[model samples]
Target: MKLYQVRKGQFVFYKNELHKVYSVKPMFRQSVHLYRLKDMEQILTRAADIELYRPKHNDTFIFYGQRYTIDQYKKPEPGDYILITKPAPDLFDHYSLNEIEKVEEVHENSVTTTKDNGVKHHEYVMLVPGKSEASQEIAYYDKELVPEEQRLKDESISYLAEKDVTLQPYVGDIYLDKRNNTKAMVVAVTESEVTFGHGIHVHIAELLDEESFELIYRYSTD
Candidate 1:
């Protein structure tokens, strides 16, 4: 960890025990001042000697209306299911649940990504799940915060059907492709097919099929 990354009040592992950062003196080589949470014993240590305290294996939390357990804490690889939180949306994105094109780098508190313009955006990295599916077997840390029955009802296909949901895709309307879990905007709509900017062409008939696609955002002229 760099000196800039160390913040007072953050939890860290020092001397094999969880300690809270009490203060930092940048002028000194041993800048990180930590106090043991259990006994309040204070100690000064170098930034490189300590490790950030994060959720490890089996630690569970409610993320994006679903519960997940931390499988491990490591750098992310392609195709791996990781939980990422975007600060702007204040939501978690899981591989199986959300539209994530790719993960570039996973940091202790943030994930960095470079866009087409070469500007980087930092998003919070929550966890890497052993499995992407939400389970009732693992007790969630925030179970009391969000009831399981309510989450099930919200995500249920039957509940969606009851609303008589309809999609009328127009130019610039955004939709999610259920087959690959990708979001695309309608760039062109013809009698038979709807074309997206990324070269995705979907048959107009598929829009009616719930398994095929779902409307994400509607573009209105008004």
Candidate 2:
């Protein structure tokens, strides 16, 4: 390698174009960085409203102005987005202050409502960081409750469908063979497996397209 002394405002060759090295440290290459932080206004010529983006998680969707992370849809705050994490509205999403309007009359501790009007906006759902071992267990189990495998499959199907690929459904379309094909309808999907019946399940690999499910094959015959 040829060593060259760098001077300020002097353009030098890098990957392609000549980039002037402003800071040359004696050691640590990162210390000799090229790109400098700048105000975003200087970088863009036009102001575009829509963002071409992707979320880091399945339940996350970039919306309005920010990504709203939710397990289900109900109320969305400003800059909040919507999510379809569960097969149906979960217990948490079903509850609102309106349902509790008659709390003084009701003896029950819990009451729920279906949000028909629209979701209110909130910046965030501040969760109490796990305080005790019990809370930790609750958090752990709640994560396990997410059914990540099916969520992953849903994500996969979405991706392949976007690519216009010929994808297949799950194999456990009710542990289906030729005999029980008539009675099969998707019962439920879970993390790591699909449940078509009380005693039926299939892993993600067993499905033709873990992402875009069409059918499911049962794990066992008996």
Instruction: Choose the strongest candidate by TM-score.
Output: 1
CA lDDT, every prediction? 0.50, 0.27
Q: Residue by residue across 1-222, what tens digits does model 1's lDDT show? A: 334488665657665555557577899989988754323346889889887754445554332223345543455553333433333432232221111223445445444331111111333333454345542322322345556685465333344333433444689988887655788899998643577776665545345434457888899898
Candidate 2 Cα errors over 4 Å, as ranges: 1-175, 178-183, 209-222
TM-score of each: 0.28, 0.18
lDDT of 2 by residue, 1-222 (tens): 223443322222232211223344556534333311110000111112111111112233211111223322233222222222112333444322211010111113222211121222231221121122322121111345446663344334344334433322333444332222334544666433344443334433223321223444433335
Model 1 segments beyond 4 Å from truth? 1-57, 62-67, 81-148, 151-171, 174-222
Worst 10 residues of 2 by lDDT: 37-46
